[model samples]
Target: MKKTQWFDFQNFFYKPSLTSSIKPRPFTAYSFVPFSPLAMLDPTILTIGGIVLGIAIIERILERWGVIDLVDQFSKIMRFILPVTFYGALFYFFATFML
Candidate 1:
């Protein structure tokens, strides 16, 4: 017996080339508005600094209210973790916004 040829295959295939005759709309010319680097710098710095300052203030408030003492058993571990987490978050926010 002879094997059937693969070229005999058929299916519901759509051809994109059928729309090749249509042309796309031309782009319009517009004025170029230059970005002010100083404007971008000020807000980004303020946001990152505000976040860090807010974290520090909250931590101090919690410590003053004896909250830290309540967790005395893990005080040392928390002291280490707090700054690292705050700074990491600050840096991440700054880097993301800058990009």
Candidate 2:
């Protein structure tokens, strides 16, 4: 009787070559080292946070100036602009990375 191992060590590190039928997954390039602290930071999240903070500051300033109508108008414009910009970014990411 032959004994079998539970883990298949043979195929553990198997990576398909370029000439093989199996296609490899796309890897996004990062400028910084993954192990370092900087790897924890994502620029996209930071950019969005900064934009929100800026809007908050502007809203406060407008409120102090008694320009509530202008703030309301700006928000209405942002309602349409934000979604279009977000979807455009989503499409760009899928087109650039997934395909």
The model with the greatest lDDT is: 2
lDDT of 1 by residue, 29-52 (tens): 875745435644566557666865
TM-score of 1: 0.32
Shift of residue 54 alpha carbon in model 1, Å = 0.3
lDDT of 2 by residue, 1-99 (tens): 899767466765575455878779999987664354543255664576577668767877997899999888878877876777667655654454421
Off by over 4 Å in 2: 1-57
Which residue runs does candidate 1 get wrong by more than 4 Å? Answer: 1-41, 69-99
How high is the lDDT of residue 14 in model 1?
46
Error of 1 at 21 (Å): 73
lDDT of the candidates, in the order given:
0.62, 0.68
